[model samples]
Target chain A: MVSNTNELSHEAFLYLIRQSGIDLDTGHDKELFDYVKSVLSSLDPLRSIDVGSTEPPMMFIPAQEDV
Target chain B: MTDVNLCYASVRALSELVSKKQVSPVEIIEAHLQRISETEPVLNSFITLLADEAQEAARRAEAMINRGNHLGPLHGIPVGLKDLFNTGGVKTTSGSRIFDNYVPIEDCTVASKFRAAGAILIGKLNMHQFAYGPTGENPDYGHMHNPWDPEKIAGGSSGGSGSAAASGQCTITMGSDTGGSVRIPSSFCGIVGLKPTYGLVSRNGLTPLSWCLDHPGPMVRTVEDAALTMNVISGFDPKDVASARVNIPDYTENLNKSIQGLRVGIVKEFFDAPLDAEVESIVRKAISHIESMGAEIHEVSMSMFEQSQAISGTILMCEAAAYHRELLKDHAEELYAPVRLRLESGLLITAADYLKAQQARALFNTSVNALYQTVDVLVGPSQPITAPTLLAQSVEINGTRVGTTAAVTQYSRPYNITGTPAITVPCGFSASGMPVGLQIAGKAFDESTVLQVAHAYESTTDWHLKHPDIAS
Candidate 1:
């Protein structure tokens, strides 16, 4: 599923780039289109590992020195 | 003098000349202002230049020195601040139209530090919309171009800081790195950017991207210069609880420290990836240079690097949504398309998913601490590729096309998750003449070691001395 999902496919990944709002003429640049797709697939936050409910979400706290 | 005056004459050099009465602050500020004007049209690095105020401040510094009054290490120095930082009574647009006219009643801690050190604020540098993007392409505020090649990008969310520092607009510029914003642009623009260990600098009055991942640090042409600037801004802040209570070391104190037999580990998983040949070559050279300097190199692996990126992204998106939830709903149509899409998509992430990411964070941080026991530093290519053309929305590296965002940021985000420090310095340029950066990452709260290694690389190479000759 990880390898075959359109979310993982080159084309759907390209769509993610388009959705991200970078200005590009998708018609002319096949390389960019494919590349954007590849990059997006890699960025899927859902794929890498299993998360548990007990852990606190990582974040930058403006005032939390110990965080 | 023409070339030397352009840049690489340290803040110390400029301040000393001013101190000796050999050069007036007014003259230094005017020179930088003229250079900014000369380069802005081509590089678009500075969104705003406070020519009037800078000149006025310079005049005062000159008057003070004449009366035998000295402020500090930054006296009479010219530097730039990212527009995202709050400046009392000045519009801090954050490169977004939403805050176009927004002004604050107080200056950000970092900005005030610069002001108090007798540093003259040249003006505000542009950034990615709300410091969200890595490529620094601001749909609202026009993109800041690379000084070396206008068609190529200056890396962002600290794009302006990177471009301005590289283009000689300032001796140093303040930038915030949330997932490599500071270091990424510094790498692409061919300068040194220090992403201090989280909490080393105060976040008060600095705009938030993700509540936990944002780090404010200095970008300069050299590691020594970064150390010089960092010494002033880093330390405990009552306004920022995240500011560490630990003593802020004299950053320059370790500049010439020997790394003889220091354990430097190269993350094979990271460098072994499909990185651009040019980037890999320069990175290998940097590692070799470090090894030659009496450091031992070992191959280290952590499967959690990818995991860290995801967890960091999840936390970033979820936390970002928390900040923008209301604003995004009301101003959905107003957001620059990419930022809106990112913030909006973040809403789809379930609470379970966010918690999962967080739990994984504790596991990953523990694993990283284990890796640190085996090595004092981890090094890698800052970007998978050099600066892509401004026209390129994505680039191909190692034969795989990757989107601009992921390719630029993948290597830099993990350190953010582990709350460790990372710095990027120009290693070399590609064949097409674009620069590549080597990132030196150290153990938690071990910024002193990272700075030492970076400063040593800088001492051995002239890459830091090179700048864009914008005009023929």
Candidate 2:
């Protein structure tokens, strides 16, 4: 639901990290936030795709009984 | 046999000597041990060297050979495993502080296969921390250096395997390729690395980077050696849920076969991206050489090729994040900076985003497979640039600044996403004397064709014969 790529403020980024159960006070918090933003930005094209009804690459198949 | 250069000898050659009783396994093992002692200080390729156990195994191999018993081509050969693989009693650190004392009670299927083939396990090779990064830089166990030039990176997560294989520390080494771990190191270290089709080799005991993407395969000095090793490792293992139920072919049997009528596809998208001039030239020349040998060369296009890195990154980040969630929660500070950041970033990827990436993966796989219907195999540069300096964060490709990680995995990662078999062979060297690799990928489960093409090119070129000056 990230509507704006540049709108991800430091405060919001830190909130997301905190919500994910990671420590926010760690020295690497900002660095981790920046990296996460970068990865999410790069995946924009894939995120925008309307993969309606298409299954994921790996799917579980149920075993059928012999006739 | 004493005068024979055991350091650069292929598994085939060494096995022949051992089978004929002309060379003792003990002597071969001792020579490698001596060479390791000399080169390991500079390369730092091994995290643990099981000298005593390897020597004892060599003694047993010698006795067996003397009694007219031979296991196979891998018999009496020294092999190294990337530390990510479980080694039973030996420590399987996975280049992380968390598992520094971790040891398994059972050998991975691949390790068991090597043992059954009578190969001596020399030690566990160092790797990128938890196979999370591609640079092979482990803060815990020093960074693995390229044998050709210590200043350059030994392309990693399987970096140590490539260094050991190239430097002749081991006759063959097993490397797990997730996002080009095997091929990147192969290209950088100037050796042959094969990333078999997903599920072709079992991943039962290897540390998981991305369960869906990880592939276990061989890294060796020559294409034939890779093929020989592949023959022993590829099979259906019931223990691995992802293991493919397919007929495993004798990969070495067709290595000498003619590739005259084969159709080789030149992926236009591969070269359209930013690439180093020398790497492009050398790879083009190698492709032309393949055409000169009577293979039909065609230009094939796939637009999705450019988006592979993104798709791969999304998938790997989410999968790896999920696997390491508990560890990150418990020991976040223990991880290397880059890996910890990467794993943390994965926690932010939404489930919808992960699924979308998988959807894109399916589309990409289908498109690439459709291209394969017209071409027997695809050929491209293994990496866009030669090995970057160990300290470099980014490299300039064709006058543009590109991140080192992106450039290193560009050509190889797409194959991993598609879950196809790809092999990197030394095609030529860069202007600075570092090695360049040419990649040949085949249809799913069609490693034989890929090996055939690589073997034909390797037999004609002298690239594989060149070794680093690390021995002295």
User: Among these predicted structures, which one has the highest DockQ?
Assistant: 2
DockQ of predicted model 1: 0.19
Tell me the lDDT of candidate 2.
0.90
Clashes of 2: 0
lDDT of candidate 2 at residue B191, scale 0 to 100: 94
Query: Measured with DockQ on alpha carbons, how good is candidate 2?
Result: 0.63
**Compared with the true structure, what per-residue lDDT tens digits does model 2 show for residues B1-472?**
6567987899888988888888998999999999999999889999999999999999999999888889989988999999999999999999986898898999999999999999999999999999988888999999999999999899899999999999989999989998999999999999999999999999999999999999999999998898899889889999998999999888888989999989999999988898888899999999999999999999999779878988899899999999999988889888898888899988888887788889888888888999988999999999999999895889998889998888888898899999999999999998899999999999999999999999999999999999898844
RMSD of each predicted structure: 5.3, 1.6
Per-model TM-score, in order, reads 0.89, 0.98
Q: Write the per-residue lDDT of candidate 1 for residues B13-40, one digit (tens) a residue.
A: 7767777778788888888988887888
Q: Model 2: clashing residue pairs?
A: none
Q: What lDDT score is found at residue B58 in candidate 2?
A: 96
Off by over 4 Å in 1: A1-54, A57-67, B1-6
| Candidate 1 CAPRI grade | incorrect
